[model samples]
Target chain A: MDPLILASEECDIAREVVCVPANVLDLFEFNSVPIFIGLGAVIIALVMYFALRKPKLVPGKFQASVESLISLVSDSIARDVIGPEGVKYVPYLLSLFFFIWVGNLMELVPGINFPFTSRMAIPLTLALLTWVIFVVEGIRKQGLHFFLDLIWPPGVPVALKPLVGLIEFVSTLIVRPFSLTVRLFANLVAGHVMLALLLGSAGFFLLGVLGGDISVLRGSIGAAWFVVGVAIFMFEVLVGFLQAYIFTLLSAVYIESSLHPQH
Target chain B: MIADVLILAEEATESSGIDLLIPTVPELVGGVLAFAVVFFVMWKFAWPQMQQLLDNRQKAIAGQIQEAEAIKAEAQSLLDDYRQQVAGAKSEANQIVEAARSQADTVKADLIAKAQTEAQGIVGKAREDASSEKARAMTEARQEVANLSIDLAEKVVGNSLDRAAQKSLVDNYLASLEGA
Candidate 1:
């Protein structure tokens, strides 16, 4: 079988199970997700360290732009969602956004066409971290009774208390992290798969056109798919930013709910 | 053929049901460590500076606004002082004009009075002179008439009379004429 066919078949399996490629380096045998994640983190750290090496009251162009990026997360995501006390969490949220964003942007790079976040490992880990943070915060603030309060909300009727509590337990404790992880992982995987399919089809069709065996109709279809592939590539860029924003926003919301459970 | 190929590919890639959704231990540990390092760097270094920059900007804007307000107040006070000074100067000018006018009036009245007194003195002296001249003329005429009458009598009688007797005779004739 062709390597492309084999890889596509692997994609189906990859979606269901984590497939460790035999050809990968020993260091990345377990999962390359952490290596890419670490690379993203290093890149972000270096950019931040250099960009804000000497923070100025009146910042230059690069510094101003970087400041604006930080402020966007701080003001829009953390502060707006989590309120005044969210100021302390701005750094964490900023790190998460930059890390995920840089990780997602790996798909656009020519040599590296794979996004680190396309894998479930990093997203799951991040989601688990968020889950832990919010749960701990809730427990610290509301005490061990936080679990009870979450499960049995104040407004439920006596008859439906058990049913509602069970639903809340599953949704808040189990489904929240699951959904957070799945949403990020699925979106990135879907985009990566779509891009791969489109590009692969374009390449295949272009070969058919160049081989002079295909009809004009098939050749035009190839050109059309190529154009579509280009368009989806651009769309993926927007998706990348949007996913990062949504992930950070949801994290902030969870943290905020933990801090102030009333809303 | 494509379906067969896909199935074979799926079979080739599939292993012992290790779910993709479940994170492996190494991946989890690496992710946690990496994220921790990044978070620490961000929280310790970048965030504080960004916050400080924002704070500095706020303080700078506030300070500028305060300085502007202070300057405006100072300008207002200076303007007020100038206005007051102008008003005072104007009032002082008016007072000076009024005092000059009053002084001029007093000097004018004094000059008029002095001129009137001088005129009165000149008129009285002129009247006195005229009356005295008239009396002298009258006495001189009377004496001349008496001498002419004596000369006429001497010529007519062809003789001269005694001084005392002539004087008495003249006086007696004049008195008799007056009584008549």
Candidate 2:
């Protein structure tokens, strides 16, 4: 079960507004996600603006670092994974990478402790965008035959052609975006939950020792949980970056596949 | 607060399973709208500037490389020309030296032949002069001997006979003695 949902249900039982609301409209009424998303976008825009404001032939330290990061996406992800044709998609890929990364890092922020990507809407939106782009690119490059390649793969024996085509259809059209969405969404949610569980449990025990009872074993367990929670929190930072990288890389791979479909 | 939040948790069976996976409409709408803004800002402004900077740098580097190659080729051509000029000058110098040596040899040979010819002409002129001087001296001595003989004969005759007869006798006697 999702820890946020668990927390929401607990909040509901206590008649309090601690976690996100359960009702869909109530979740919409909740404005924290939008505020954080705006903040992430603004931060990204400012960083990009400053990084390239005084574009130089000989780059300074800040410019070099920014350029190196852009190059990593251009060289390693888009061009490397999707070939020369992928140059056009660098903007989209760069945007996706940084946006998703900042969104994921929101979970670790002090006042705002929810990763925007932990919500299903953001990952779903990004994944759907990737799907639309690759599909459009495939159609643009290869024409209507793109769907034909997906539905009726070449080199299959006539007897097995139908089965293979069905599998390919589901795998290509359905699984691509679905997997993209779930992979990013699930990883961030899991990280958020793990942090919440560890820290919540630690605080419960430690608070009990300090406020109510001073038990040695409770204090030790609380200290251990807090230590582990801090460690996991640091690990979540890496997870945030990894998830962003994976999502962008996969998007590039899908674009490649669309550009050059397997016969 | 954390302990209270946790302890409040019970076996809630209300929302479970795939319901959690579903996305709310507002959040989805807001997320899409937010991302659209981000993508717009990035695609519209940032990317083009970055690409321009990169492209300008690339073109500048390429131009510099081409300029460097052109300079290197020009330098090589100049070096080759200088080497050819040096070789031509060396050959010309050798030819001048050879012509000067041959001219010196010819002049020396002509000088030696001229000296030999002059020495031969002087020796021939000296021999001719010596022969002429010896012939003159011989002719003078013979004339003196003949004159003395004639004078001795006149003294012996003592002037008794006529002058014409005496002259004839003396002539006959000298002639007869010469014959015998």
Candidate 3:
């Protein structure tokens, strides 16, 4: 038995591990990521089902508020950035925004103190979907010429064409999706990890104080850290909404560029 | 024993934690399918109703504006008609006044002419009557004088002269007097 193992076990970073649920059958092991995604889907479906089941020309407060959320994405993200042709993509963009938002907000729920987006898989998949959409749209609208034009922007000097093309390809094809995936994943993961650490340490301190082992100074520090954790929790709420907005906005910009690459 | 258990736990975590950053095939498939279902439901149900409501509102507003404009034009035309009718009535009243004044002037002139003609007729009739009366009076006086002179001559000659002789003497005397 290594003393290093003993020391490592005491560290708070161990809490960051993915939680795998027990296998219901011999076939598959259910996990938190899939469960939360499913939960988000159900919530979205229910909201749409009730709010839009019997729509009115004059909307009530609940229906109006829901419609306003939808139109915010439609008008600001899709129409403003992507223009009139963007009307076609409003539903898809709205779903993405709301799904991500709900997934991110799971961390705030009491027992479910984990955001699904804190995992890399969901963000990566969503970013890939965006990547596929923009690339396909570009190809469909511009033909094979889409790749050519994307790789070789018009403003560059003739001597630096290949260099610029390489940079452009790397950035557009690889870096864009990678950055999108990492930005959402990292922000949520960092918040998730920080909260776990602060709360975990606070719990330890509280236990020590209850057991009459911790000094008054350490107890007070633990209380202060707990307070800080609460404050971060609130801040993370804001971040969750912001990241969802930013991801949708970037997706709209990418789609716009695909549609009208001349700009 | 605790150290041994902690080492085993650390090793297990290190091995299994790799899956966190890497996506499982099942989860990926589930996410994509789930999102696809959501997108379909929203696109089919919600969007069309919202667009319809907005369009209905816009159409209602446009209709109201057109109706207001029509009413305004109708009111304007009616006002113009009333104004024209009033102008016509005013001119008619003025014409009636003018006609009545001219009729009064004509009536006054006729009365004056009629009165002057009647006065001249009365003056001429009075003068004719006076001249006729004077002629009658003068004839009557001459007859009286002749009768009185003949009676005086008869008295002076007493009773015995013949009737035919007296008459002839008188006539001869009278004729002599005329010749002298």
Candidate 4:
């Protein structure tokens, strides 16, 4: 038996699943990503189904509430960023935001504590979809010369064109989607890791199984940490909702910028 | 710390592992089947009815708005007609009052002029009758005066006057009478 493995085993097993390697951050893995994506898809279908199964003059309470929420998300995030012209994309953005949010929330279930969004693959895939939409939509709307708008930016001087063009194209092509994916993935990973550490450390502190001298002050601090962890977990629920919103909001803003440019 | 917990959970899962993974290839197949079924059901049941309901609701709203506008127009026209009728009635009453006043004035003047003419005609007839009566009285007096003087002269001349003188006077007298 390896001492390193033994030392590693001292930590909670759930923490290993939630944490990722430093080296593999750049690589894309598909294993758990599609599974969570599929889960999100199922949740979307059920929500749509349950909300729309029956027909009524006035909507049922649940359906009406869901409809209002959907429309609110549409009006707030989609309409505010993309304007009324982008109302057609409401269904896609609404489903995407909710699906990602539910994926984050699924890890909070008692027996089902694996944070799927903590994996890089899910956010990366969604970011890819968003980037594809923006690029395709920009070109489709403004023709192939839309790329020129990114480079020239319409109002800048000819002397600075080359430097600005290089910077703009690189940032537009790379940094935009990269930031979106990494922001969501990093937030999920950090939030999950923080929650696991706090919760798992409290267990060790209360039980005193770390083989060091246990004291009344350490145990009390552990209780305090445990309570604080609970409070943070509650706050993290809010963060889950916010991060999903930010991602969707950023994507919408990006699409808006891409489609029209600054010209 | 959670890693150790996860190991325990993993060991437990492995002892009675049921393969929770939903698989990859089957997803493409199941996704198609599921989406197709959902689309078909939506097309068959939900869409047609929802569209019909939306159309009917739009029509109902439009009809209500049109009917309201029409009623408003009708009410406005009715108000205008009533106002015009009231104006006409007022005008007609004024004309009738004016015509009656003029007829009363004309009739009053005609009555006044006719009364004056009647009074004048009566006065003229009375004046004519009085003048004719005065002429008749004057003629009767003159005939009586002439008869009385002649009687007196015959009485005086009958005894006083003898043959030739008396006869001369009487002859003068009788000659005068024949001449007159």
Query: What is the C-alpha local distance difference test score of candidate 2?
Result: 0.77
State the TM-score for model 2: 0.66
| Candidate 3 chain B superposition, TM-score | 0.54
* Best model number under TM-score: 1
Q: Write the per-residue lDDT of candidate 4 for residues B104-155, one digit (tens) a residue.
A: 9999999999999999999999999999898797557545554544555557
Put the candidates in TM-score order, highest first: 1, 2, 3, 4
Question: Tens digits of per-residue lDDT for model 1 on B1-180?
Answer: 234434533453355323555567777777778788889888998898788778888999999999999999999999999999999999999999999999999999999999999999999999999999998987687677677778888888889956567766776777687689
- Quality of candidate 4 docking, DockQ: 0.02
Those runs of model 4 whose alpha carbons end farther than 4 Å from true positions after fitting are A1-36, A55-57, A207-217, B1-180
lDDT (C-alpha, whole model) for all candidates: 0.77, 0.77, 0.75, 0.64
Which of the two candidates, 1 or 4, achieves a greater TM-score against the reference? Answer: 1
Model 2: runs farther than 4 Å from truth?
A: A1-31, B1-19, B60-180
lDDT of 3 by residue, A23-85 (tens): 101001236558777888888888877887777666899888888888889899999999999
Residue B172 accuracy (lDDT) in model 3: 69
Poorest lDDT segment (10 consecutive residues) of candidate 2 chain A:
A12-21
Better model by lDDT, 3 or 4? 3
Error of 3 at B111 (Å): 24
True contacts kept of 1: 0.63
lDDT of 2 by residue, B1-180 (tens): 444433333212133434457787777877877777778876887778888999999999999999999999999999999999999999999999999999999999999999999989899888888888877865565444445445565577654445556556656665686689
DockQ of candidate 2, scored on C-alphas against the true complex (2 decimals):
0.23
